[model samples]
Target: MLLYSSVGKLSAATCSGVAKNITLAIVLPRYNTAYPWAWPRVGPAIDLAIKRINHDPNLLPGYSLCYVFESSEDDSGYCSDSIAPLVAIDLKFTHNPSAFIGPGCHYTCAPVGRFTSHWKVPMITAGASAYGFQEQKTTYSFLTRTGPTAKKLGEFAVHVHRFFSWTKQALMIYDDKKSDNRHCYFTTEGLFYELQKDNITLIHLPFQENAEDLDYQQLVQMIRMTGRKTTMQAGIAFLLPKRGEGGKEGKNELKKGKEEEIWRHFPRTVQTKNLTLAVVLPRYNTAYPWAWPRVGPAIDLAFEKINQDPNLLRGYILHYVFESSEDDTGNCSDSIAPLVAVDLKFAHNPSAFIGPGCDYTSAPVARFTSHWKVPLITAAASANGFYQQKTTYSFMTRTGPTQNKLGEFLIHLHQFFNWNRHALLVYVDEKIDDRPCYFVAEGVYEQLKTVNISVLDTVFQEKEGNVDFHHLLQQIKSKGRSE
Candidate 1:
């Protein structure tokens, strides 16, 4: 089913003021920003996304999909110096932006996140790809990014290293340049973190992003000095860096030409010989550990069971390319886009995608797989919404949790406690603009009603952010004393 998000408690009449037509605002970099070439491409992409969404008859029927742009004369999308004007433009009452797109740079998105988190307005970014965004989802509840995220890059590095059984890696990164270009900087940082978890030692190599002209001979010599002896047979250098020459380019961190020179120096793709399953997960997500130790072990147990019988399976060693679905919070609609990316990067090489592991993640992920065409097999996620969403979520095959079971569970709870009275205490986000949790509260209220329990009262949190449940507690006490 589509995510039934109820943004606010607006009456049919008053709602006309805020959402007469669905308008999506975009904050792109100006033509004269840090990367002039990239900004031109960002405009067309936003236009195309708007066009596709509008043409879809099933989506937003009777609602005109309009967009507003927010950018300065020569501004790059950054957090500290940028995004304030963008946020101000969006917050305007005169046809304020219903949602946001663009301002795709990591620096700009950080501040944009601050506005969205406080206001509760949904935003989708096509440009930014920082790994830190996933860790800040609770702070930026409304933001969703289509990314070349740090986690995705890290996972790709881990996959290649694991395939070759390499225990040490040279952590190559561009020198700290303009803050606007931090997306590239953080990607290598994320790659380093992922390697550390696998007990791999990473040697740091600081290079430049725009390495146009540099001494190729010194760079080559630096590689040899690091311990990895280079045999230049063709255009490609087929060796990982030697241990001692790790920081050979240390003093030469002055230019923005590291990555380009490295590619101009060493290039070739690595290939593995195993039957691979690219399992998409949120392993880099410490907020949710459901993917690794939770569903990861379950896959192992199944494989172990299969390994015991030679008659059942022969001549095949199944291994998993565990790809990380970068997440900030539990809301993983953003995570689904990266699976499409990583899948294409390997030419749809994954056997299948395993669990996203909860209702929050699987909701959006299930819908995307219809287009992604990869089989999404969920483990711990038992949302009853799955079966009804079959048409939209065609690629999904779930093996846990059901609404009927939850219905039975609620009845059992009342039976055991001998307390027939029931109610919901929903603490809404004080942001009157909109809150996504309203639908969740409605779902719980309906489910509780189905189990034949009478709801006496519904408690809402106070405007100051804390739940004022003292009165509700007193009522429960009074009811108990009377009974």
Candidate 2:
């Protein structure tokens, strides 16, 4: 959820009638040396970025960029959400900053986000990555995330588990009882939920710091015993060790020295003889593009060629079943797509999926395929949202250009023409429709915002039976758009 707000002209002016530099209050855990987010690590990067932004004549045109740093004071190692916001509040009133760009810890960023939203101030950060931040629209409406969130980590974990065909695992979380932010616990909450949703047997273990009464050796022995039993019963035992001791170092040592131990646990078996591929599309319908006549024959030919080659899929024979994504109206239906996917999954136990090619239809079906750990390949569903493979559109592979790429092309074209100001006109159909223009316009608008292009006005026209070009033209004219 990346959001950037343009800094407007300030009322105050210099004696020479020059506008003052726009100030951004940076709130970070600068004083906290225990964490990597401390000033010594991230401050130099921020300084360099600000210098580049100020130097760029193409961005923010008349206005200069400046910033002041305020320590959020996460001195206790874990970020204090409450303390961070109070610091922001002080800076907000004192500096009257145009925007904010810090509080880089997820725990600290969230509270400050709530304040910024209410104040109608934009806040940019590389943190606040916990899963909750993705859905809390009202609370973090003014907040912009410059980095990937924990939700992607959760989805990637699920993807990795499915990729390895692993059915069981153990996750270890560190519980810092004295700290306000339990970084490990909050970050992996989404991962635990995903594993549970997949019906995978997940053993969750949490240990507190400096618990002298707890027997460390006995705990390790218990886990080792469990690993042996799990291997015998489930044919796999996966354990994620804690940091500093048996984490990266242990895994590296196992890879180097314990090759025989790993091989004994994971014995090689014969490849699966058959794998089903579910090909979903508007098989008989021609209401939209990508009808079965257009794409089905090509898919069939490709599969036939692959199946004929003995070395392609080793000894496994690829089989495919066709399912229609069209509804009674002869159009691709989002509702029907998932039902067909579920039916195909149950009947064939497919290893992969293809088509349900329409953008609306493919999205919902993609979610199901991602959860089932099945790859969904399509030349359609070219919306910008599908680019988010680690989150909503996990397991989806696009074999064609996406709207985001189109937006990028448009941006380059605009830059070439030196078009800084323009009016955006989007035509949305009033009746039941695919909303092609709305999706394209949305992607273009977001892309334009990143480069600080001035959009004079956005006009949305609902097209019904009779098109009114006069009114739309008049509306755009009223905005006095030059480009």
Candidate 3:
């Protein structure tokens, strides 16, 4: 599931010389937490594309492209059939939309595409990549896919299988059998079906995707028990004699042996003391871009490189213990992060904290690291407070840009363009701890106000699902801005 770029260009090409009042019903998920390509993350880029297309004289000739957004997701961050169909019906009657840009999730996309295909209206999406979409041609005849499909993924997996020459495979998948939550099931169904054609024994192990009471121990035991007879088990176990610094049998063990002849080639004086770094992250199963599966290997590689170098941190060896700040549902908790920090502090005596990458989760962990006088390094935690509250998070070090820097950059942008006035629409869900847009809007507002730019109005949306687009549009209409 990758978000393809040049959405504006694609949209422009789709709606070229369509009509004067050409409106596209743009369906998007409200939050980016669960999916990175959600509307909150990609909405601005889409808006900018529309803006550029509208302003360009040669592009559309006389026709100007416009969009009406319909947030496709419900409160739990899954696309809702109940919400989307109603919204689509309303948009169809009210806006008289020329086309449908998206309803990215397979759940919403399926129904919406049915409507569009019947209406002879073209609907293009960067999501809805399930293989079912490919098979259901008549239902989705007018639908256009702009992203990777599960069919291609299945083909890719087949290639991998052939390359490995594996005769048997255990296909462990997070398969939720619910209507809205069957993304994993749909994605893997292609692979499962494709593998059935091959000459290999495959075991499909389906589990609850996000159940809070999910039995992890049972899952582990099940993995061990499944296809145990056929799978070859190979591992190396180290047997260290009681001849260490604190060992009681050290004198006796020392008398029994000298270094082996093969050991003479290596430097025995290399650092032996282990320095533990607490590696906090979201769960590996979450499929987030920064989750443990993506980040853990990088951390291990870095530690490997550092520990291999004899001069780097000369007296100590580098190691890490991974801890998840998020649960199965993908919600990062402030409390969980601190608890992880306290546990790692005592258990591993960690020299530093590597993450808790979420902005909300990073706060408590940062405070803990600051109190412990150990550095908290992260590529995330880009909110304004992290940079502003220097005294509170003095030991916190960011490897990337903060909201303040973004605010500063926006200020320069406004100044360079000589933009005087603009309206601000800030979405802050009090229910959700991750309010990235709110923080960014705050920073942008502060910076823009400093230069005496006329603030027409600042609209605050408390809920993503409950945003009154009609009221917002009315406010803009009342402000007398035609653009």
Candidate 4:
């Protein structure tokens, strides 16, 4: 069972001569039905990592951590509504947690970053990759990430453009409403500027808003206006809008609206082998059982909806490339055998092969490997799952700092301030949802308790809307004075 306390400091219950307690908080961005993909695999991955950390003695000597999981379930109307309440709740009721992790999306990260900055708390972001969260400029102590930044993605696009020699008169499509779109635009613009320095003619077409109800007629008219003689390479950025309260309703509406507007009017040019459609999203093989059979359905469905439009019926190639694993053999020999027996309850199939890229198999794969001595490696998962393990088989080999590192940094901060007692705790209410980050916080809390740290207060906050910060601050100040 996942135990998360909203208020009151964690304490050792000395039962059966075994005393253990620590408190850590995890703040996650609340997304409505519109943003399902925002945290598709992050929540589960974080939970598994925390479970491993708490059970592993090598990670924390005697500590058993407790977690508080909170979410800001903001809808499209109010992007930061869920996160705003968390800031107030964290400031008021949460114990001075050893560390904080999350606010996964870039939108929520901005507000969380501001809140943590004031307290000098070290925040580790597993998903957010906003523009200013880098080490040099941010006031926060640390900002770690598992995903590539938009700038890196932009540079890659430019490299591809140069390699293909499609530098002359390129038409660029962008979404103006989202931060992600802004990042892509700025990054792509920078790349285009550099390409222009080499005397390459670059033509940019900026499209405001999302692809929903896109002005396909205007787009087609513009294409025709450009004339048949002047054929320019195009770079299109498709930024999806945030989902609404009615989950499936919003998606269906978006599909129907997009089909009437953009997809319907696109020119049905013959399938020119040279005209390539490059997607910036991660590329996964549809052959893998986990991804191919599961996530593939959604991708295919989305495409099917797109193809329903007359213009998109003609062949339009969509090519995608994700960061490949270090070992890209399409075989799961080293990883899948144990998972089949222990986790999935499937007999080991020698004929089964692994996919070329890593899927969301990191957490369950890591759990079976670490806790049960299975031999598997997840190349794509970025969560801190494998850190702080004694067994090589159970250890995570992916790139990124472990929760142990974040805990150690917090410990160092406590020592730096000469703070020995009177710690407070604040965490999210995990009962709301089963996100994995809650477990990571719990693991960190356990580690702090093992080291004899005393927590003064713990609080759980709502996942959305306005949070009363003034009340939380008053509580913290009162607790500090009493201590």
Candidate 5:
């Protein structure tokens, strides 16, 4: 939740050898769209946490805390999109961090989780509520999260449903294209099933692709088909889309126009009836834009747009803002304080550093501390290759694959599929366009080259707009045959 800074004065102990210096790597997600929401809280939280840890004499006696920061800017909403580049950057750092902190989103957590699990590093995350963390029972030793569990989400839904008194006929709308949707589905359905023990009617309206437009239309159709007089309660309505601007625009249009249109068809008296809109903040801070005023303004604008719809039912739209407080509870900070304390207790033979998240801190901090060879201890980081090779090291205390894990999988695929014999690498250019997708593609290319696999041909795709898969696929096929 909240992170605070404190200073404590203590008596000096007996003299000892040089104190070990620990480097903590905090990796932050760098999507321009999501940064506004995440950085304001996460950045300040880390800064305050580190300051508090350093000031605590008992926790880190002889050693001073060093920090490494990394950023993954892939806006595609896939964990691998950001994790791969982050891990590649971490591998380049000279310091061998003892631990790593985050790849903020569940999508980023998956790849980072796999990598840390392989390297036996401690990984801790403040967010990332994906079910896989518990369902798969990841073997990574130090994996943990400070956020609410899926079951808690179910409970919240049940309360909302009970408040509405609409036992049955609940509609659930989710973005089928994203993994986050699965989380929403399970949590909502679990709650619905439990509440329905009283014999309520629940109608599941699941939309798979083009969630913004298509799904919204499907939901309206279902509402209409249920009849205008039907007092229907809807479960979590994922108004946000996976993609950045593209998704936002689509969602905005739907909630602004189509949602109201559906309401207009209903009788005026029924329209005046209360309709609850359950908005779930699956990933904290991600819902808001990355900038300060912009973040605040964007949320305000979104709400205003939704409210402008005259058809919005009379029941208040309950926006449950589920997020970690900024206060320093010490739960997250305590996890890494001991490691720093231990390093100092051991006469600083091995330095200690602690971090809160992986994608936000580790890579950047690693880059900064590469020259010192400082070790970092993290509760979690979801970057792909943070611990690859012997140079910079990260102890992923939690579960997730590093870039190497994904690279290893690619290597196995190369061997199994024999695609390594001759391959055509298609990637977007980074120098002219510094996108996370290009960075990941390049990272994968470098890994493939390490195994004596050379790219027979390279293709650069258009940077902006929708990708023309038909032409791109044909080109890839042509190149494959030529090679």
Candidate 6:
């Protein structure tokens, strides 16, 4: 399960200047079941995201976020008996919420659908990814989701099948409990049709083959006496919640709402085959501040294309999981690369490491973790000479151009403006236990020298980012150089 909790400090804060706060109702459902949540920190993660948005004045323009955590009883599959009553009773109707978030379980979304549809309130959920909710849009007029959809899940399933080169498999549905069976029913339909189009044979069942180990040797020896069957090379089980809730009226009425309206829209296609993609958000990379968030969608787009055509990646499916990376200078909390890699190794066991973005953090991961076995793949991290020391750092690979390539860029810029002499500004912080402060400066100087650029002088700052360039500007003027 994804267990990281994100930045959610100011989720309920009212901006200092904003007189009125926009309220959102957060509905976290407590499903009475044995299966643990895929990500136990879903609630905190949402709060953290909300806090991030609230603090960014440019994002919302005129809003301070106010939200109430509403825990509703959704034990039974029937919505009216559990969810509907609690939503009506728990939520403050007078101070109308601008929107409602969550009801994470697939079954709980039904009541939110009814309420949101009736009041025309916008609803957002991070989970509850059942398929076919879009067909009944009138009831789910204002719903959204930040996670994957039923069709995407189906496509992902197809990708898994394609990855294994398996033409035959069992499709397990959770129809044992009527209320809890909605997800299984929808998943079965959605995936059945998708796989059916691909000419894959699918047998529907209500449970996993490993439900018990009662198989006898004689039964296997007879080629399955009941019927002639090809080997079931894979099994795709839909393990969704089911407690059997709501009567015919609930299904016909409130269940019409879907998570599709909440957010996230992607063009869908089924790709063949499967493989795992692991990524670490480069949050600690001081050089590229905007890199972290883009990784998620970038992975999405890559897989989207691969999945669109079964033949695009003929024999494999691509799956991606990303974890936040950090160091002392704010990459991600408690995420010093080496330790984080160890945790990930035991927990998720990624096939490869996508990145920590910057060289400082990526260096440790490649040097230590990748050497342990998993390869490290990165789009950035052009600094710190991994390419020059290729044999020494054999496991590290760059998807991006080298840092020396920047000299070519500098040469282009120099040619464009007819610039000649350059003065280098380097950050000097000799505070570490024993290491030298001018780590990046030496490399920068060498790259410039390699490109035949003449350096007029090299100036030093007390720290990397604490430069007061006004004094340096005066000295530059004394030297009478502009470039």
Best by lDDT: 3
Model 4 vs truth, CA RMSD: 28.9
lDDT of 5 by residue, 118-158 (tens): 35566677655543355334333456677665545655656
Candidate 4 residue-wise lDDT, 1-483, digit = tens: 111234333221111235355555566543342443233345566556767777787976677665555554444423352233344234324355656666556555544554454345666765444334442243333455656654455456557667777546445354344433144433444444445555666553444433354686787576555523222223453322222110001111001121121111223347522212111111233343333344445645664565556465346533221112111233222122221222121222111112222322344334333433334433334333345433422444544335565666666766677665554546433331123465456546555665666645535345535567677677677665333
Local lDDT at 69 for model 4: 54
Instruction: List TM-scores for all candidates, in order.
Output: 0.37, 0.42, 0.41, 0.36, 0.37, 0.36
lDDT of 2 by residue, 310-343 (tens): 6777667666777677655566765456545665
Over 1-483, each residue of candidate 6 has an lDDT whose tens digit, in order, gives: 111122143234344465357777666543433322222345556567768888787877677776765444433422222343244323535356788776655656654555565567788776556654444455456777677666676677678888878676553333233445355555555565567668887653332233343343543443344323322222334433222122111122212222011122234336433465566654434445435656666667777787667676666666666555543344332113433454455555667777766665565566544335578887766664676667446777788765556655666776687766667653323332112224345445566666577765534435436566887777566553473
lDDT by residue (tens digit), candidate 1, 1-483: 222112232111121233347766555554554543244666666567667766786767766576655452232233322232333332333356678765666655655554554456777776446555655555556778775676677788778878878776543333343434544455555565667778876553333334454556766566655523222223432222211111111111111221111100111124313455556555544445465646666777676665555564465555555544433332333333232323332454555666666564565455545544768887644544565556667888877655546656766777787766664444423332112355344444556577666765433435544445687677556544223
Give candidate 4 regions above 4 Å deviation: 1-22, 29-47, 75-82, 85-93, 132-136, 139-141, 165-175, 178-202, 206-483
- Each prediction's total of clashing residue pairs, residues at least 3 apart in sequence or on different chains, is 21, 1, 0, 32, 84, 27
Q: Report lDDT (Cα) of residue 313, candidate 2.
A: 77
Please give the CA lDDT of all the candidate structures: 0.50, 0.62, 0.63, 0.42, 0.43, 0.52
- Number of backbone clashes in candidate 6: 27
The segments of candidate 6 whose C-alpha lies over 4 angstroms from its true place after superposition are 1-18, 30-56, 73-81, 88-92, 157-175, 178-189, 196-483
Q: Residue 148 of candidate 3: its Cα lDDT? A: 87
By the lDDT metric, which is better: model 1 or model 6? 6
Please give the distance, in angstroms, between residue 290's alpha carbon in candidate 3 and its true position after superposition. Answer: 2.5
Candidates sorted by lDDT, best first: 3, 2, 6, 1, 5, 4
Where model 3 places Cα greater than 4 Å from the true spot, the runs are 1-271, 285-287, 427-433, 454-471, 477-483
Q: Is candidate 3 or candidate 4 better by lDDT?
A: 3
Worst 10 residues of 5 by lDDT: 246-255
